[model samples]
Target: MSRNVREAVWSPDREQIRNMKMYRLMEKNGIADYDEFFQRSVGDAAWFWEEVTKDLGLEWFRPYRQVLDRSDGAPWPKWFVEGKINAAHNCLDRFVKDPRARNRLAVIWEGDDGEVRKRTYRELWTEVNAFARGLKQLGVGRGDRIAIYLPMVVENVVAMLAAARIGAIFTPCFSGYGAEAVATRLKDCKAKVLVTADGFLRRGKTIPMKEEADKAADLSPCVEKVVVVRRLNRKDCPLNEERDIDWDVLMSNRKALSAEATDADTPFMIIYTSGTTGRPKGTVHIHSGFPVKAAFDAGYSMDVGVGDTLFWMTDMGWMMGPWMVFGSLMNGATMVLFEGTPDYPEPDRVWMIVDTHGVTHLGVSPTAIRALMKFGDRWLEGHDLDTLRVFGSTGEPWNPEPWSWLFEKVGKKKVPIWNYSGGTEISGGILSSNLMKPIVPCSFNGPMPGMDADVVDEEGHPVRGEVGELVVRQPWVGMTRGFWEDPGRYENTYWSRWPNLWVHGDWVQVDDEGYWFITGRSDDTLKIAGKRLGPAEVESILVDHPSVVEAATIGVPDPDKGEAAVCFTVLKPGVAGDENLKRELVTSVAEKMGKALKPKEIHFVSDLPKTRNGKILRRAIKAAYTGKDAGDLSSLENPGAVEAVQQSSAN
Candidate 1:
């Protein structure tokens, strides 16, 4: 085992271990060993999920006849068979029954310019019911699609629940997506209504969201009605009298709409995730599937519970937004939504929010941490974050330096950072840090309980102590039903690689100590001189230098080698990108990763293109540098970064 894997940075004490939901579940089931319980979870999905839902106190209008039915296949397995449930009912209605729970804070929101908003469970339920009635007044019904295109606000969550309450499917587009990108999703789902804001604040600037919503609605002829949130109250806010309605006007009806009793397999959400070579693929998530699984992961893995606050810096379009919402609400914990960049106004904005909100479980991306780390530890000095118990990280692989910085500085070497890995299609994490297990820097304890995950060679055989393909051998409750209107594409994307095995596109490594590390996306892997390389591996080496803030590596066409590695780096402020520094970085990688894997060249730029959730757009970077088509840039948070990359290539 490597030195990092051998040395565990964090471990749970007896009290911490006893308090964990996973440990309690094991004890309740008479299982003394965690590894044994994990094996049984995968060995018997039915028993495991039954115990989990029972533990969650899940109530069903109609009880499930069976736990799982895989007669069709692994990809199409039906969970909680014959059960009738509603997502909004579980998320809101059940909590309202208890007088104490009803008044507890459920959603805490922060705007770009430091404005704050808080909604109790009762208040959130009231808004949801009103919006449900509004959606019904517009003639929306079960299975009807609603496209939500708005910033991170309380209204976005309201729109989602209201759609679910009425049995309508809602798809969220990134708040920063352009008109064309928004229109594409509207067209694909043939949405009946669009929920948007007039405008919202971002970095102290007013973004006219209604203008893009209007343009997108113009292109999507299927959109029959548009609901405007009047967030900015702009005087020039255009409205089509025939099809547009103001949110306050529509919500004039304060009556509650009865929740529909949807079957377990009934689809409630269709989240569209962008692929490398095609239009976004809509991943279908069901009532019982996503909510139940996400809640389980949050409670069992992260140890979230009642009265706790869980905050993830994310947008509604990203999977983590919904993941945070469902997980926190279902677990009776408060969820925090932020509408601006973590570093906006000041470098300490994120830490300030956590301290102000009393956040117990905080989630952030490595890229965001790397950016904040440049501001140094001074920004974090004044914040009192004693309430923080754990940190959640996702979106991309972590570099050890940033991981250590977050662990040592922000966490005060007390809180553990849970490295979470999953995709939109999976609903929640395939791999996550368990509170019961010791944490290695930037390494997952193992697969999330019941994942049945393994690292495998090309022939589907298991491999350890080396990097290989990440695969899951069994279907869990959270697997996507299929891509919307594209079952063939879904099967081809995941299942065609191996029989009854899901080839999750991430390249992973399992050390001898059983700690797991995600390298990067398999599609993003670079091959130089017949050797495979994960960009994160090279990026980690480059970022180890004090001058480099971030780095991305890509393979380009080569005459001798099959492909050669080309690197782009974003430097710390005022650092000179001289030839000497470039040579130093090259030698650093060559010494650590060996000479054959050395980067052919390195270009320093102002920024790296990233999604709203802070995942580096390495594909876009490669495309811009090589003069190729950069497919599906709608998820990009900064389009100018791509232009900067192109300019660098020219220079």
Candidate 2:
């Protein structure tokens, strides 16, 4: 265990950094050091993005005269003004002309049922063109909304690229989302076409995706056409004769169509946030904005290239899914798509996939590492992960335990674990670890080159060593224009708190060394006896105990102190939730966090409620314990865990 805990520095060679696109661009512009170069880039973002776009050779039909048009306001800034380009052309069409990339595998997908599918660049081009024509045939024109509800299958990628090909906006719903959640996004966007699959396998069972799609379509009156794929030849596949059509039948014997020419700022997608409270906000992204932003993150931040096969464990609905797919393809890199849960069949599936596929870059969540660590290091030692070059993670804050496990067990203490922190509003990462920088255990080295990210108190004053709200001082290319319909809600959610500054919900701390650490969401920070602490600090200590599998801490009301910390824990499979064991766990936390910071009550449950993408929902547990409504359980992958928590807290 001690071997797993140490700081690692993975610095690239001077020649390697010199060959990178960012470094070459910086050299061309006479910039030398990373800090000075980044300062100049954000100091004048218009010129920086313009240079990067041209450096990356983004194919455009018509170019723009001006770089940025901030006529409206900073919040509504327009990027690459008057430029005409299609995201599909930049991602697929341009690759077709290059012989090296034309036949390379664009996507490699694996299903839970041992089914594997592969597509090359040429093949992906044909399918995307055919699907774009199919969408046109179904009356989907430019600016039309198309919603896709499918698993991580090839069709999911096809649907997204096809929608962007024809200049239509697409919304992707999580496969695990219930009907109401699906209905809300589709209805809000007023989707004209819905692409869904009959079913997909999950935990050795089939989930009727088409059935849920049907339920959502029934509630969404704007849906004019339903396209269903035959994932499972089940007898009960829903068929609406009037509006529904077969996916394979529509694409049979059809010729590929030409790509659409669209303005750079044309609307591309409307993704909803998986927030714990209230209705999910619909964030609007543009073609030039998100694709360009994602490409920058991949090329510069993650150092992914054509020779790399990048795989990030994500679903179609989350922001990272679209971010990875579009970013990897635009860079002419191969992408790996898994259609099953990571821990199904066995716990070492993550390591197995890297070994089998020879993936060069991998991304996962800290929540997943914590769950996998409980199965022991033997599972990790079974596979050879020498192929992995870079390790990346997001979704939640990392604990030293799981972060160390990932660094030592799988990464062999050699690969750099780049910690990225961002949200759906920003297309990619705001804070990221660069190849040139030495990574701390669980810290972001600095803000990504183009973002003016900072930590500030309630008064909007800069602070160090103390937790504060994370904010972006300047607008970037990928900042969402606004919410779907309600400008007031969008403004209130982000800009209302501070003047001209975008208020990110997370609370972060910048240590004396200038390394940034996000505590958690500001709302989730526990304030006990006037001393505030991030739940991650408490949960990290609890998860360090060998018997604990996962933990979530929240501040509940108390008579003596203003608030008291209460922890909900999920034990290992064989570990019993006896009083003796509970007492020892409480004492352990006290020894680590001091007596005042110790949890007032400790409850053990069979599991912790988390989203399909594996984000522990502390707010949901608190709501369930206090008899408040758990708002919007659409992203809840395991409602049974919430029920377990409720029952245990009551006892």
Scored by lDDT, the top model is 1
Candidate 2 structure quality by residue, lDDT tens digits, 555-618? 8898877889899998888888899988888898788777887889999988888887778888
Q: Count the backbone clashes (under 3 Å) in each candidate.
A: 0, 0
Clashing pairs in 2: none
By summed lDDT, the worst window of 10 consecutive residues in model 2 runs over 1-10
**What's the CA RMSD of model 1 in angstroms?**
1.3
**Alpha-carbon error at 138 in model 1, in Å?**
0.3
lDDT for model 1 = 0.91
What TM-score should be assigned to candidate 2? 0.97
At residue 223, candidate 1 shows an lDDT of 100
Residue 430's lDDT within candidate 2 is 91
How well is each residue in 436-469 modelled by candidate 1, as lDDT tens digits? 8889988898898888999998789999977899
